[model samples]
Target: MTTIAVTAPHAPSYYAASGLPQPARPALAGAVQADVCIVGGGYTGLSSALHLAEAGFKVVLLEASQVGWGASGRNGGQLVHSYSRDLDVIEARHGAAVARSLGSMAFEGAAIIRERIERYGIDCHFRPGSMFAALNERQVRQLEHHQALWQRHGHRELELLDAAQTARHIGSGRYKASLLDRSAGHVHPLRLAQGEAMAFESLGGVIHEASPVVRIERGDPAVVHTAAGQVRARFVIVAGNAYLGGLEPQLSGRSMPCGTQVIATEPLGERFPELMPTGHCVEDSNFLLDYFRLSADRRLLYGGGVIYGARDPAHIESIIRPKLERTFPQLRGVRIDYAWTGNFLLTLSRLPQVGRLAPNVYYSQGCSGHGVTFTHLIGRVLSEVIRGQAGRFDAFAGLPHLPFPGGRLLRVPFTALGAVYYDLRDRLGL
Candidate 1:
């Protein structure tokens, strides 16, 4: 068991380079008391803290690093609906009742983000429209089914585009079809996180940075011990996703920390529009996928290449640049300005793992790399469960979260081998 820490500046991603300035938050000092003590400072934790504080609860949030320090601030920034696995898969593995319940709230997370930006006046470059592109006939058929499946769940805002239409919007010939969701959007993630932290503070919530919880003395009033301080609270929420290593044995086993790297090019200026004609964030339909979008300043932000364990590529660009060039050959020599990597929790079920770790201790993790939007929704659900509205929370809890077959020790190798099969299928257009 190891602990993750980041007593440093945010990664040099383009989002961090251009996002709004943030106030330096203080670390936990002495002993503090609150109705709730939330661990982690990423999307889920911040969202949970903000909503909980707004609900009139005294909240204290502890982050090992600054806000948006993990994947929350370092994702591809393409916000869309649905879980990591599609709704049909959820239905097949679970059941209609469970799938329907999860599907109904699929779009709510994106709505929550938009509402936050509008309500808190957060300037995270909230841009609407997300496209799921199909690269082969099999993928096209899958998308066709995806559209119908979403429609059955009361989602009718999807716009299907033929190859020509897809080309028009995508400015690339690699895709055969597209499913566009007008309500889904992209944002400046780091800024959104920072803005959210500010809003939480404004709502009388307290945030302690660099105060990694070293131990949790669980009880009626759980005590969360940090390196230099402790939080005694009525309830505790563990919102740390992938960056949370070894904090709890149960959590580390049921979830695997998967690493993904992304790169941002030097301001593309006029060339940006040629690449993303409509400026809609796009992700291709594949088991392991590629997602890209234009930054507010017009730099092309491309992300791909997933690693099952914690080792990041020696140089992220060395792995991602080829994908970027392959996707847009015209930008063969494009100057890469920023490259970095972050980890997201992946569950064996490919669904989010959310429920109580103890009677008074709750947790939410493993968004399966599709967490940017879902985290916000889970945040609300967590707050609701903490306050006695367990109906919605129970829906997620009812879903099974199996531990990796080989546990943490061999889960990485086993999962990586399984992924190679799907990667071949994707390559063969199966």
Candidate 2:
């Protein structure tokens, strides 16, 4: 694994500058015994620890850095439903039976987030409504099919808007139309992650920040070792995602770490509502899409673009500012207050990889860019599996995962070339 300095702070993003104050957690020192051991402090690990602790299991969670310090704290905060690949693609690849099952759980993750906020009184800025802005007739047709597919699967909260209607709602003339999912929403992602960790601690779960697991000994009771401590538990879950480098060779080859950048503009003041009249979160329909939403304090949190192998650029703003200006030319001179970069585990099929390595060693990763809501679902399902209920967990594990082509050395460059082809297609409106 890439060794993280113990004193590393949260990324200098808007999330770190203005979210709720997170509690300080100590590093793991002495050996501990628990029913379950979890690695990573992001949404997946924190949610797993919270759910497991609520199920009356002794849980210990270890993080290389502070809670929500990774992509969990650095996402665009769109609480979107479903997987990266929609149900139609899933049905085409797998079978209708599998698609039906996945479709049923598509909205469950968003619902879980709502319930947790109410149950725990989390202070994350929760907002309703998410829309996919269509730039052309082809995109509009896709949204039409998307709305119909979700409606068929019992998601009736979607409403398709014509070009005029879309312009009125979002106050942007760029889109031909949009599909609004009132059930989908946005939030202060970092706060939600930290709040989940706080809730877990309240339930007697133990957390050790800055304690990265270096090795895992697979046995009856798994032994997870850190530099200064070790956890002996009946079950172990690896939720490190993109940051989990070189840990488990058998499970790591199927996905690649892809980088993305985000920029938060200085408070938009009165211009915020003019850009988005309905105050809903907006994501484009392009394969490489732009997702933006207004923060509670009225700042625009915009994120887009991707790079395989996750080589972060030195000046994030230099690259992303032009993308933002192209989307909203009205905000051409708007000053960006913060910019940060993070990576998500991307799979070849653009679907998550969930399965058990050993009987007692489980993992869930490769949510692609759709990790915000799905991580919560995976966490709950993981807890269910550890508690003798494996139906939901098995459903996801059954999904096929293929390794990235070109092996480790060539996969990055190969994916970069593939991205170029896709970008051209997007530019040509294909």
Candidate 3:
């Protein structure tokens, strides 16, 4: 079996930068039992905890660091309404009915986010505009097809924007056209993750911080061994995503892990209007995508670049700085206040992997860069499946997923090669 050592959560993320002060929670140091045990305290785990707890099940959540410590807290924060992969990809594999169901659930994910924000009164700077901007004619055609697909399912919340209309919304000429989905928007991810954690705790769910899961013994009842404690539960949910580590070796190399970095600039003042005039979250159409949006305080939190084969923060600023400058040359002199990197699980097909490693052992990961929305939805679907409603989760239960080539010692080399191919495509305007 392939093995990879685990790393701690990312440091000083933009989500951490924009939030209130946090207190340290004690780590797990003993044995415990629950109806369900969830590994990883990010969006998926927390969402599972909230739903299962509300359903009257005793849930225990284990976090290697703090809650929101993974990609959930360190993402680009663009809550878009779709799977990371295209609908055509889903249709080709799962057939028309299942693919259409998966597509609708993608929109349901956005609705779930909005519902949580309002119901819980989460003050995460919830904004309601997201635009999938296009850079070329091919992308424009793709966006129009996407708009029609969603509209056919009564998701009329989306509207196609021409070049002129797109410029009016984002105030950047980089995009030739775009599709504006009014139902989706951006959020302070850390705040939302924390709110879900708090809600889980309120419903009597137990959470242990700084408790890295070491291994799992699968049987009638599974045991989750942590560095300091162990959890025995009737059911186990592995929501670790790219940080699954050795918890489930079968899942370890299934998705390639690529590091994405972001930089938050010093507040742009009233000059924020010069960036995204419409205040809509924006992302370009490319494999190596560039996404940026202003914080509530007006700092432009810009992010892009895919680092495979290694975890190095030293070269992040140099690689992403020029990309930021190219997008808004007006802010060439703006100083970057914070820069950091987080890993996303990119699958071979760029879709999500949600199914069972064993009948009682469930796992969900590989959302590409689309986890901010998809993960939360998967959490809910996971809970439903656990409660004997597997129809929604089954749509994604079977799909093509190949493990990273070159095994443990060479997974990076192989993934880096694939990343280079995508990088070249992005540059050549493919």
Candidate 4:
């Protein structure tokens, strides 16, 4: 297993570059005992803490870095209703009643975000508007099918836009059609994660930053080994998704860390309206997706490009810049102010992994770039699971996950080969 310590913080990205200056959060210093110890302080861990703490469980959250320092801090920020996989897959795999229940929960995830933001008074620059842009005829057909599927599920917030209508909304002629979900929106992800952490701490949860869990000794009372200190808790939840390395080899094997990059352009002022005229989060239908949205301050926040291995900002910028240029040729000379990359876990089924590693050790991961809202819902569902009500949690927990073939050494190469075939099919419109 690859267990190199990642201490050196990369240069500030768009989220860090624009966010309010945060005080240096200290690392774990002394031993602690709690009813539950969370291994990562991202959205999943914080969400779990908020619910568990509210339910009167003593909670301690350990972060390898600062809160929201992982993908939770650095994502495309689209809070959509479903995973990358089609809904029919769930219906086919599970019974219709179970699939419908899970489907309702999927949409409920969006409501959870809205309720949390309003209840907590979190100002994360949230705006409602998300478009699934279809650039070709085949994609347009797929969107139509999805529209029907969602409408049948009584999710009527979706409205389909024709090529002309999509062009009017996006100010770009690239899209053949689009499905707009007004309830789903975008936000400053880092701010959202940080706000949730604040809420959790306000509820009497203990959070320790820069505290990486080195080992886990599972039993009636689990002990987590950190570099500086240790945590003994009745329950342990590992919420570190893609960035989680040797911490849980079995969980890591179910998914691989794939790198995705995003770039933020300087404030475009009047030109911002010309870029994304409708103020909607936009993503194309290609398998290797291109997603963009307007910043709260009216800058173009564009994200695209997927790399198999770890690379630096310069390399990420090189791969993504041209993709941005392709979308808006008019903004060719627009300088990118900040560019960075984050890792997201991808499962073969493309759904989240939610289950118990042991009776007391639970985990939820593999969001496939759709975790922003679902992770929060999973956290609440997990709290319910801990309370001995496991209906919703089991919808995902029942799904099986295969370890990547050839383990760590050859998984990347094998997945890269599969990704290449998918990329080619996407290009050929297969």
RMSD of 2: 2.0
Winner on lDDT between 1 and 3 is 1
> Could you give candidate 3's per-residue lDDT for residues 1-430 as a string of tens digits?
3222244554776778667455556677678899999999988898888889999999999888788887888888888877877676678877888777887787777788888888888888888898888888878888888888777666898888899888778767778898888888999888998888877877888888878888878887899987667899999999998877766777877777778999999887876465777788988888778998888888888898788743757867787889888877777878888898888888877888888978898999989888988888888999999999998888888776776666767877877777689778767767
Q: Which ten residues in a row have the lowest lDDT in candidate 2?
A: 1-10
| Model 4 lDDT, residue 365, Cα | 89
| Per-residue alpha-carbon lDDT of candidate 4 for residues 84-143, written as tens digits (9 for 90 to 100) | 665777888767876787777877777888888998888788999999999788899989
**Per-residue CA lDDT of candidate 1, range 37-126, in tens?**
999999999999989999999999999888999999999988889898888998899888988899989879999999999999999998
- Candidate 4: residue 396 Cα off by (Å): 1.3
TM-score of each: 0.97, 0.97, 0.93, 0.95
Q: On a 0 to 1 TM-score scale, where does candidate 3 land against the true structure?
A: 0.93
lDDT of each: 0.89, 0.89, 0.82, 0.83
Summarize candidate 2's per-residue lDDT along 1-430 as a digit string, tens digits. 4333484789899999877876778888878899999999999998889889988999999998888888899999989999999999999999999999888888888999999999999999999999999988888899999999989999999999999998887767889999999988999999999889999999999888888889999998999999887899999999999989888876678899999999999998876467776779999998888888888888888899997899988988988898788878888989999999998999989999999989999999999999998999999999999989998887899998888788888889888898899888878888
Candidate 1, residue 30: lDDT: 80
